[model samples]
Target: MTLDTDPGVAPQEEKLEMAADLTAAKEVAATDIPPELVAQSFGGYLRAWMARIRSGDSGVLPVLLGLIGITIVFEIISPNNVFLNTGNLVNLFQQSAVFMVLGMAEIFVLLLGEIDLSVGYVGAVGGAIAIQLVQPVTINLPWWLAIAFALVVCALIGAGMGFLITRLRLPSFVVTLAGYLIFNGVLLIILLLGPFSGYPTLCTSSCSGAQNNSHIIYQLMWGTIDPTVSWIGLAVIVALFGGSMWWRDSKRRRSGLVAPPPSLTFLKIALIAVIGVVLLLICNANRGRGVVQVVGVPWVIPIVLALLVVWMVLLERTRFGRYVYAVGGNPEAARRAGVNVNRVRTLAFALCSATAGIAGLLYAANQGGLSNNVNGGQLVLYAVAAAVIGGTSLFGGRGRALHGVLGGLVIGAIYNGLYLLGLAAQYQFIATGIVLLVAVTVDALSRRGAATGARA
Candidate 1:
């Protein structure tokens, strides 16, 4: 039988043609898939995480909730102790303030996947200069003027470091290491000029515990507030936070973006209120024994909060923030996107130093004055640890300014709580080191999981 005359043979030819048409259709479909469509399908993995929470998976909430649970348990376990005291609680906020600011400063460099070792020493240098400027025998600048000058000088030093890193294309590790040593030397040099020869002391030698005689900067920072005023301050803070949240959420809704479910927003606000009330109650309870009654929120607390908001916005809101994240994630890509990577990196370094300077000044104020032996090296380690422990990635590209608060509070709590329990500072340091190591390890694992998900 001839093939054209055979019905079975004709049907086979038609079947082959149909198969070819199917294959062609598939090819067209594959080509028609837009790159953005492909990306969106894959990038659902990168969602902001609240989705998972709304679905009831614990995610990071467990870690935070666990910390709170532990705190409550310990509070109950040590009922008579000052752990629950309002004064100590407020002091904890004050104590952690500088660390939080320093950590934020560190965040800028960290987001670029760099480290700034000079921050501690630089802070000391800046604070010392500020103190010198305000001393009686010197320029005797007003406290405000002296502070501004000190911060500016610190910024210039940072800017200088940035210039070196960007212009010279030097490794930040080596550059900042050199800065650390040079600034430490500058601190000593600035300090040796001493008590401003004609300025009698601000207080008696006994009051200052300085044979050299010093000003009561610490007293000035914390001693002036009335005990009852802390509650008012706390109320104001709560009100502001509530107002800001409402405004932001309203903005998001108006923009036609996915607003967090109102339930989620209310939960967040409630959490803040709970924490705030607890803090205020503690502060109120811890006001006085009989003699050295201390009270009111420290000036440092508000300063730290303001800086946190600023840094948070810079990292999370602006185009600059997006660039920072991009540079940290893939510098080559950022460069292709027209970012001046070197300039950004340098600025990050400078900002870090300036922040460290602020922290240093606050540290001095916290102690009431500068001391030659103030463990700058140790403090730097704590800052780094705090940044990491609060969930920042050592590998970079995966953290936020708010993490610094988490990390700072954790660090401060460990130190203050341990001290209250009579543990030596050495043990606290050792514990911090262990916590930092664990945090880094966890972050590494998380990155691995994220990468695996991306590939999948």
Candidate 2:
């Protein structure tokens, strides 16, 4: 028997009926949906998050716990507890900038399940270019131009290496290993050919006027923000970040998309605000010795944060970023989906190299010059360790720029604390290796758990 209903009669009732049907269907299919997608409130979100953790997506939890644990250990054991002292902590951030940037560079390749061993020397080469050009003697270019030039050259180097890997279909390990040898030779030649005994330095205290180029580069690693200005900047940054989070979440909810509950979003904002305030308080403290009063945040802190923000945007917000994950997770699937896998791989390598170049600049700034004495080999190993320790998967397709930053901080803390404890560099290396091994183990177990759950 067939019964027909009028299309024009009781239109509002029809919509209501349809809506109810849709809701019923959603309820029936709820198990198929991600818990996070189905959650509509803060408590539900908590439960959903817990489920995810159980499924092996721990996110940044390990990094946070490890960081806190390390800090406590070092503060208790280091000579006079200087590890947590505000002044020493600030220095730790400065020293870590290089590692952070290098780790970030490595991440571009790591996410693609590739590696770049040449980063240390590649970055050094870029740093040498910047220092060489702005020497205030021979190629006295503006600091900004010199920096741009260095970055461009570094990017090209990366692109070249990427081309060799993609077009030649050579294994990244082999290409990058060869790149390491080639770049190291290039760095030596550049340093040797230039003045300063394979070390090029920016003009010292004598820098002035146009020669301020060197001074500016130097300040990137050594300068501090004015106290009042630092406060203003922090306020601006917090407002922007909080507003963006709120807007995005609100927008998602309004559009009937998957989003965390409002309370959870607000809580996140609040937590971020608290962290910012604490950081500012630490930096604003008078860490100066005797009569000298050193207060205000170090320039490196903001610079590193800015780098983190930029890279995060690239990886999380852009289509290219999605493609990156897709390729890393499964290149064959990504290729079938119309992604330009080769192009993405090539660009990833280029970006990785450029990032390494930035780390090189940081190293140069930290050392007060570009010197052949720079330990590119050790630096590369640390960069890899930092990325892995920060919880980036060695198997690829799972990580973030923040991971690199946190890992770098962990390494820096260990390095700094070990030195303060009068432990040898070898001891620091051993500690880092152990930490990296633990991180990898955790990652492997989590992945296995996830696979088993999926099978079930």
- lDDT against the true structure, per candidate, is 0.67, 0.84
RMSD of 1: 12.2
The residue pairs in collision within model 1 are 86-282, 86-283, 218-368
TM-score of 2: 0.91
Give per-model CA RMSD.
12.2, 8.7
Model 1, position 290, has a per-residue lDDT of 82
Off by over 4 Å in 1: 1-66, 69-80, 196-220, 223-241, 291-293
Please give, for residues 1-456, the per-residue lDDT of candidate 2 as tens digits. 000101111122345556766777767454443443367866666666666667777777787789899999999998887888999989898988999899998998999999989899999999988888888767788989999999999999999999999999999988988988888888888887656788788655667786799878887888889988988987998799889879987998898777777877788788878888888899999999999999989887888889999998999889999999999999999999999999999999999999998888878888888767878888899898889888898888998888899899999988988999999989998998898888888889888977776555
Query: Would you give me the overall lDDT of model 2?
Result: 0.84
